[model samples]
Target: MQPQLQQQQQQHVLLQQLQQQQHVLLQQLQQQQQQYVLLQQLQQQQQQHVLLQQLQQQQHVLLQQLQQQQHVLLQQLQQQQHVLLQQLQQQQHVLLQQLQQQQHVLLQQHV
Candidate 1:
């Protein structure tokens, strides 16, 4: 009978040891899960940073295109203004010639 009681006690100790080992394994699994989550967050942040850089690059290119277009438009406007002024000058010269010819004809009639 004493041997039987001793065996039961030994069995209980073994069972307790197994429970402890199981608890340790659960703790390790929880820690691993936490590490995995942190790594995922870091990866997400890196992707966002890359996307932001791409957007900034696109914005810069758009700004350069707008500036180039503005420069071309300004040049065209200057050319158009120059042509208009030249035409106005030519018209004034022709009007002056017509007035002078009319005055000469009137003077001849008066004679």
Candidate 2:
């Protein structure tokens, strides 16, 4: 009976230790899964940031093109205005010359 009791006590201690080891292994597995989830989330965030940067770069390029087009259009409009002003000045000069010639003809006829 003494031997049997000793054997039973040893088995009980071994069973408790095995249960503790199993609990520790389960905790380790949970920790590893949590770490993996965190890593995946970080990777996803990195990909999203890269995509946003690319989009911003594209937008910057497009904005630059628009500004360049606007500048070219303004230059063309300025050139057209300058040409129109020159034409008006030339027409006024021609009209003034014609008036002077008509007046000179009348004065010669009267004399």
Candidate 3:
């Protein structure tokens, strides 16, 4: 081959190799960027999951407190009902005693 033609062919091959290397480097950079985005998304999801668990725990605690308050209120109502029942019984006893005394006086007068 002529010397100038040989040098031109070698230069062409070198240029093609450099272009291929540039393309490969571009592809590698794109893949790395995609991986970084995925890692960021995964971290966000984990943070959201942790926040959801904390909210659920708080809800459970509030529910337990509400149930305890309801139980205490129920106990107070029952005690009030028991007191009212006792008062009614005492009033009935007093009325019965009064009726018996009035009957005894009427019977003596009739005799």
Candidate 4:
């Protein structure tokens, strides 16, 4: 009877040890899952950084193209204005000559 009682006590101690080991294993699994989640988030952030860099590069190229187009349009406008000014000056000279001729003819007839 005494030996049977000792055996039961030993079995109970063994069951408690097994339960403690299982608890430790569960805690370790939870920690590993958390680490995996953190690694995934880090990878996503890196991908976003790369995408942002590409967009900025494209924006810079577009800005340069716009400035070049503006420069060309401004040159064309200045050339057109210069041509119009020359034409206006020529027209003014022709009108002045016509007026002078008319005045001279009228004075001669009066005299």
Candidate 5:
């Protein structure tokens, strides 16, 4: 009866040790899960940051292209205005010559 009691005591101690070990393992597993969740969040934030940078670069390129196009359009408009001014000056000169020639012919007929 004494050996039986000692055996029971040993079994109880082993059971307690096992329960403690299980509790420690559970705590470690919870910590690992939390770490994994944090890692995932960090990775997601990095990806979002990279995407934002790419978008901003694309926008910058588009703005530069638009500005170049505007500059080219302005140059073309300026050229067209110069050409129109030359045409207007030529027309005015021709009209003045015609008026002078008509007046000279009328004066000769009166004489």
Candidate 6:
């Protein structure tokens, strides 16, 4: 082969190798970027999950507090009802005694 032709062929082979290496490097860089995006998404999902759990816990606490308040209110209402019932019984007794005294007075006057 002529010396100049051999040198040109060698340069051409070097150029092809460089191009192939560049393509492989580009592929690797793209794969790394995709992996980074996936990692970010996973982190966001984990954060959301943690927030959800915290909210659920808070809800449970609020529910327990509401139930306790309801129980206390029920007890208070029962106590008030008992007091009213006692007042009604006393009023009935007083009315009955007055009727009996009036009847006695009428019987004496008739005799």
**lDDT of candidate 2 over 1-111, digit per residue (tens):** 999999999999999999999999999999999999999999999999999999999999999999999999999999999999999999999999999998999999999
Count of backbone collisions in candidate 1? 0
| Stretches of candidate 3 exceeding 4 Å from the true structure | 105-111
Q: Deviation in angstroms for 59 in model 4?
A: 1.1
Give a tens-digit lDDT track for model 4, residues 1-110: 99999999999999999999999999999999999999999999999999999999999999999999999999999999999999999999999999999899999999
lDDT of 3 at 9: 96
In model 4, which residue pairs have backbone atoms overlapping below 3 Å?
Answer: none
Listed in order, each prediction's TM-score against the native is 0.81, 0.75, 0.80, 0.80, 0.82, 0.85
Pull out the clashing pairs in model 6.
Answer: none
Please give, for residues 8-82, the per-residue lDDT of candidate 6 as tens digits: 999999999999999999999999999999999999999999999999999999999999999999999999999
Model 2 steric clash pairs: none
- Cα RMSD to native, each candidate? 2.1, 2.7, 2.3, 2.1, 2.2, 1.9
lDDT of 1 by residue, 1-111 (tens): 999999999999999999999999999999999999999999999999999999999999999999999999999999999999999999999999999999999999999
User: lDDT values of the candidates?
Assistant: 0.99, 0.98, 0.98, 0.97, 0.99, 0.98
TM-score of 2: 0.75
Across 44-80, the per-residue lDDT of candidate 5 in tens digits comes to: 9999999999999999999999999999999999999
Model 4 backbone overlap count: 0
Q: Candidate 1: lDDT of 110?
A: 95
